[model samples]
Structures are given as structure tokens and as C-alpha cells.
Target: MASPDTRTQLLDAAERLFAERGYRGTSVRAITDLAGANLAAVAYHFGSKAELLAAVARRVIEPINAAQCAGLDRLLARTPDPPVAELVAAFVGPMYDEMRAGDEGGARTSRLIVTILSDPAEEVRSWTGPAEDAVRDRYLEAFTRALPDLPPQELWFRIRGILAVTAVDRVEVHNRLAGLPPVAGEAAKQWAITFLAAAMSAPPTGT
Candidate 1:
């Protein structure tokens, strides 16, 4: 097999470290050391550590975003007004599928996404860009169609809330922290999907 180029090596290293230690915990030197490249390589290729992180986030997130959008599109094509549970499954299922079937690198990318979603560091939090906005808009549109009675602000709030909950559960469930039994494989995926669907379908508050 052909060897990975320097940029690819740097991205690989950044993804691993960002996923494992988070962006704040990882340093440019650590990434270079893991990639077997010199420190200047990151600057040369990505411009800065922040840019490298943005690139890593794009690589990890774009494919999954596409999958999610496509899934929702297919559902809408078949059923213009799909049920809430189906919409949730279409939108949220791809990440779980990736977690279940992707290789080790892919799994790390999934964790990296969850880390990015939950990371409190200002730099990490600010990394989201137009691509993510587009995905969010696409999903929001589909969900709006599914739940027209849901006030727009409430819908957006619930969506963000469930996403935060889901991110936490994905990490905590996978790590089996506090000696809690890990819910693995398909069961865990279903649990997450069901929880999200229920939250999305919940009656609007203050009705």
C-alpha cells in the first residue's frame, strides 16, 4: 500500500489525540510525534493547530452528515409526513451505524465528534462552520415538517437538548464508567434512537 502523505499523517494524529485527550489536552508537538513528522509540518500543511483541528472535524463529520441528510431525504421522498420516530431514526441512525460498523479509525472519528459536541474549550466550541450549519438546517427542516405544531424555538431547543444528552450517553455507555454495565452493539443504538425519538415527539411545553 502507498504510504500516507504528511498532511494525511498529521490529520490522522490530530484526530486520534483530539478524540482521546480533547483539543485542549492535545498539543501540536504531541501530534507531530505521533505522526512521525516534524513540528513545522503542521504549520506548513494546516496553517495552525486550530486549522488542523477544523480540518480534522471536517473529515470526521462530513461523511456522517451526508449519510444523515440522505437518510432523511429518502424518508421524505417516500413519506412526505413521516412519523416522529421514523424521522429521528433517519436523522440519528447513521452515527450509531458508523459506531457499530466502522473500523477503529472510524470509531475514533465518532468519539471525536462527540468530543467536539461536548467540549467546553472556547477554541473547540468555535470550530463549527457553515458545513455543520447546513446539516443542522437540513435536519431542522425535516423535523419541522414532521412536527408542524412544535413552536420553532421549542423544536430547536429540544433538538439541541437531546443532542447533548445523546453525546453524554454515547461516551458514558461505551466507557461503562462507575462499573455500570455497558450497553453495547445494536441494543445501545436502539436505546439512543428511542430516547431521542421520544424526546422529539414530546408535547410542546406550556400547552
Candidate 2:
């Protein structure tokens, strides 16, 4: 059996390289090389490259999902019917917190999310799986309760937009809009929450 430390190193290396090179683009030898383990270490610890990718997805996504669920739990405990802004905040605050962390882990996570969101490959997206769906359903259910007036489809659209804004656009904007004045951490986070809340609360235009 590979030592626990080797397993951790492989995970860390895989995450970084996967974020940079993408799942299909990264190779087992490259992962092991970065991790300082033999090429067989991935097979020993994770069985295959697909399994390693899944493990990396779980490593980054589970914590964010757990934090979002916990935030929603706290909100629902106090206010069974939260305002859209509060609901949006509860759902997205953990993500922004991670983005604002200013560390290697945070950057890796941000890149991983962007990679997952933008990668057209079905397999790349499938890594999140039922865990992602379960958390998403919980939030959508909460939003439905909060805004029964809106059509369920509309609410889903807004929720997806909220996620895209927070997960993908936020990072892309920073890189692409370097010429623009930087929004400070707290201010930028609040801007996202406020913008998303407004979008969620908007009356659907009869099309």
C-alpha cells in the first residue's frame, strides 16, 4: 500500500495540474512526477485517472457544498422564509469566502470550478455528480419556498445564472478586466450577492 503522505501528495499535485491542464490534458506520469511518487502510485491509491479526477472533485467541491448547506441551515433555523438576498447570501457566501482566501488552495479551487463549468466534455462535468445535484436541489427548493410567485423554471434559470456569475464570471472578470478598477474583496462579494438577489427577485417578463 502507498503511504498516506503519498496519497495526499498525489491529490494535491493532481488538483493543481488538473486545474492548469484540465482532466483530459493531464497525464498519470505528470501527476506522479509532480507528486514525487512513482507512476504506479495513482493506481495504488485511486485505481485510475478517472477515479483520481473524481477524488480531486470531491476534495474541493465537498467543503464548499458543506459550507453552503450549513449556511442555509442556519438561515432556515432563524427565518423559515428568507428574503432572496439572504438566501442568495447563504448559498454563495462560502464560495466568495473561498475566492477571497488568497491562498494556493483557494486558487486551485477557483480554477477547478471554472474548469468544471467551462469544460464541454461530459466526463469533466460529471465529476461533481450526485453531491453537486443534491446540494443544488436543496438550494432550489429553498428558493422555491422563498419565491412561490415566480415560475419554477424561471427560478431555476436565475439560480443557474447566480452560480455562473459566482463561479465562472467572477474569476474571468478579474483576469479580463484588469484595466478596470479592482473591486475590493468585501465590496466585490457584496456586489455579487446584491446583483444576484436582484436578478432572482426580478418579476418575470411575460414572453
By lDDT, who's the top model here?
2
Model 2 pairs whose backbones collide: none
- TM-score versus the correct structure, for each prediction: 0.85, 0.87
lDDT of 2 by residue, 62-117 (tens): 87888898888898899888888898998878886754443443555677778877
55-96: candidate 1 lDDT, tens digit per residue: 988776777678887887798799778888987887677766
| Alpha carbon lDDT at 181, candidate 2 | 50
Q: Top TM-score: which candidate number?
A: 2
Error of 1 at 77 (Å): 1.1
lDDT (0 to 1) per candidate: 0.77, 0.80
lDDT of 2: 0.80
